[model samples]
Target: MTSASPTRAPGPFSRFEWLVAGRYLRARRRDAFISVISALTMIGIALGVATLIVVMSVMNGFRDELLGKILGLNGHFTGFPIEEVFHDYEAVRDRLEGVDGVIAATAFVEGQALVTSQYASSGVNIRGMSIGDIEKLPLLYSSVLYGGWDDWDNLEGVAIGSRLAGQLGLGIGDPITIVTPNGPQTPFGSTPQIRSYPVNAIFDVGMVEFDSLFVYMPIRAAQVYFRLYEDRLRDGVAQPDLMASDEEIDAAYERVYTATAVEVFVADPDATARMQLPLEQATGRPMVFTDWKQRNQTFFSALQVERVVMFTILSMIVLVAAFNIISSLVMLVKDKSSDIAVLRTMGATRSSIMRIFCITGTAIGFIGTIAGFVLGVVLALNAEAIRAWVSNTLGIALFPPEVFLLSSLPSRVDPVEVSVVLVMALALSFLATLYPAWRAAQYDPVEALRYE
Candidate 1:
């Protein structure tokens, strides 16, 4: 009886197919050159991935750190009055506060001024915000090193940045004199508005711009300092004496509770680019809205461009490694022609032969990619320690604070970015295998066996 034609197989693919694929990956002593090339290919890919990981992580850290500081001091979107001051600022602030994305909305006044202490004098940006607003900002509140936000609320003093205080040789409780550009208009021309407030706190925002030039005062004090009181006086508000009591200062500040701009903090600053029109429409006033991205576009744009350029340049190293994989596989196919002929004689199909080499080449790339991912993550996590070690050992500073603005090297790996890198590596490697694997598959079994 003719037994039922031998069952072809139970599974989709034969076990023998994988067994032969695995065997092709091992090199005999005679094929030692191929083995060496394969090893070099793996090493090159690993190094490229590791370097890319370190660089991208550092850039991500830099962007995040700078963004945190910038957003800390500034707003996601700021609405400026078309006129000199926002007369209906409370209405505007209330409207903005009711917006969906706005977490907090506050009135702010910022202007250039000269601050003087007993020891020295420096130009600074006099910024005014309410005590309640200051307390709402953890970045500002937690950065206070010497005193509390309560001091600013009590109208007892103002908070100056750390570098400003250092330059003026002043500290908390020391008196700081401010001279505003818009001074009282007197018959003897306009004299600079001068006011002295005790330094109630010192803040270190870790940014040269902020630390060296910004001084924070209560909204009323800032109004008085910036001559906003002049507008109040015009509106039938009584002018107070220089040694005005706290009650008088409160009344004066309340009368002129207008802001030059309303700073709106959002849940996501990155999305602020698209919110300008919406914000302007919501404010229901003829106001101009400026987002933080627009304010620092050049800086952030440069970083993004550099990151793209760096990624492209670094990916070339992996491409070169892929070339090595091509060469090794090509040589391997040439050397194993006799084996191909024998396997074909043993009933192996042409597609099976191609899959064997493809598997071999992909295994090399897959293994190398895994090794690279591990090495990259380790290096990125310990980048600071590595920087310190290299600096100490080499007697050199890799990134100087004076030049880089940051005190130390920083790195932060994003998992999504890492996954993209890994995928790129594997794709390049698998693509590199196509030509060589196809070449192996094209061998004429008749001619190959004729020579054998």
Candidate 2:
């Protein structure tokens, strides 16, 4: 028995591991039909990945751009009362200032009026603000395309939006008549008066609607012009016949003067409700607070829905490519059945047989996914260049400046999004290999050898 000991053989890997895997890939190349199918599958995955990346990045860029436009034009939150006027505005401002998240507090008068120039007339929204308070708002400071807030401080002058100026055919230092409801005691009786203001400067915020409708002036000037404190007497009541006295006029005026409103700016745009609570308590008015999100909810919601729909549609391509992988693997199992049986007879484990096919399928997915990711990043980073190339080559604009807010294509490739996409592609590829690999591993050595 001691003399009959036999030498142990080396493992199968040392004998034929590299050769087996290399031969499988090479054999695939030699089969023209299989090679074509594999090539198509690779192309499909690449196209799918590339499209998904470009589309998602573009959507992200668009979302950022749209949000910037909205936030820049409008502040995060605006706190105002349900009533036409709020009394004790100073108290309201004090309460808001004491709040944790409030950035700034300012008082403003808002009303509708008709603006008339010698050559034209246009209806506009009159916004009255203190020049000092206006400067505190960062959006206004940054958006000052022309002129400064100082222009509003001057009593005789008003600042008009650039587009409004264009529409009215007016410029700086031009005289414009503003007709507001101002109650003045004339020789006959108290009647509504109209005042004229000189346009001192023009500002353009790059937003067409704001430019066309907004006109800013000093708060005091607006209060004086509109005569907010003037009271409307009861119908059929005569001043002398009813024996109305100065005390009554003074009391009525006091009623109007006591009403005031404060607008607070919050640090976090999303804290509108929190900021409103303090203002509502101080003013004793029903406070209505609005944020940018609520203001443009429809637009932002549409963008999100579009993104999801686009991603789902593009994912179908990857699904189709995965199916192609399944087809390739099934064909591969048939081609390798004889070799699988020979290896089994040599005591190769079923798990190793399955692993070989799994590795092959995973290699294909990995290669295609990586290639697509690289290509997508390159295209996304150079989207403007690609857009220009397409435009120049086709002699047509890919993204028309008039149609889109941005003149060129925009893209922002987020690393996290790219990582998720790559992981999904790899997972799909791995899943595609499982069934075929399992089938290959279940091959019977005797039956496979008999057929060979």
Candidate 3:
């Protein structure tokens, strides 16, 4: 007697199902149109993901560079006396420096003045600070391209920015004229104080606005020029004489120095809010304080909003590519309906047929996402060089430092953000396949083959 043939079973997603999926994905000349559509879908997804990564990276770069430069030059926060004058600035400065988490505190005096050289004239902001304070700020101290620090404290001496020097055609040891209306008042009215100061140093801070508009002078000089001072002697007003003997100094102290405000530097700028109260208590005075974020809120808020809008708008590219995936799968399901029906009649499970189509679509998504991730990372790593190359080869100004406020284009890729983009792309692609795969699995074998 002949033994009964053992029944065969094609388990869900078995090699048989994978084989069928691979065959369908292979581009046949007869289904060339569907093959082209699938290819375009993959290309679309790749381009979309790459663009998202690049744009996000650029935005992050811009934010970080700007914040560093801003906080580097301006410190994290500042305070101006609410009473209009910080009496005994030396004591106040010392107290602020002694506080925990405080990097340094400077008695900062600032005033607006008109500067003129043989070449040109411009309105500039003069910062009056001691040489000791300048040493604590790396942005200014490390950026001195010419001249020495000793000359900064010399009588009628100053430090100017590189761009300012260029504009005024001034160099080290060259004198620049400053005119401030807030100077000592005369019999008629307020008279502009005009003084010529020799340039001791020139600095380029890699920022346009600051480099062009800032002038540094001795704090004593600033206080004198801005008319911010207090007389100690009850008789005629007299400026302090540091060389006076102890008996002469005791007889009548000429004057005491003062400041417009105190600038505080902290170890952690992000902790500005938490440090504010402590800093105030340390100052031992009533004061009004301002932080960097508070000062540049509008500018930073706009940046954040723009980043979100850009992401939302660019994500539509991936969404459209996902729609392309759905379209290609739908056409594929129609073309393979006969094969699906034949398999069903031969005892193939419905789940196996569905998995076949799902695999085909998801493979495209996975490969496309990987291609995009690699391409995006490479582009971000070389964004600045690429920008320079493109600008040079095209013979055009791509990013002018004066307008863009930076010497070069910046890009920084975050690994977490990139992973998110990849996962999102793959998820969209997988979702695009479900309806078409389900339709293919639901085909009735009897009806599908009756007409064939």
Best of the candidates, TM-score: 3
What is the C-alpha local distance difference test score of candidate 1?
A: 0.83
Candidate achieving the largest lDDT: 3
Cα distance off (Å), candidate 3, residue 369: 1.3
Which rank order by lDDT, best down to worst? 3, 1, 2
Candidate with more favorable, higher lDDT: 1 or 2? 1
Please say which candidate is ahead in lDDT: 1 or 3: 3
TM-score of 1: 0.83
Candidate 3 has its poorest 10 consecutive residues by lDDT at 3-12
Off by over 4 Å in 1: 1-14, 116-122, 166-169, 175-181, 186-188, 193-196, 231-257, 268-285, 392-395, 401-410, 445-452
lDDT against the true structure, per candidate, is: 0.83, 0.73, 0.86
Model 2 root mean square deviation, Cα atoms? 6.5
TM-score of each: 0.83, 0.73, 0.90
Clashing pairs in 3: none
- lDDT (10s digit) by residue, model 2, range 327-389: 988888887789899999987778778877887777777778888888888888888898899
In candidate 2, stretches whose alpha carbon ends up further than 4 angstroms from where it belongs are 1-23, 26-29, 87-91, 112-126, 155-215, 220-262, 271-276, 282-286, 382-412, 445-452
Q: Model 1 over residues 13-54: C-alpha lDDT tens digits?
A: 456767876877777788788888888889999988888898
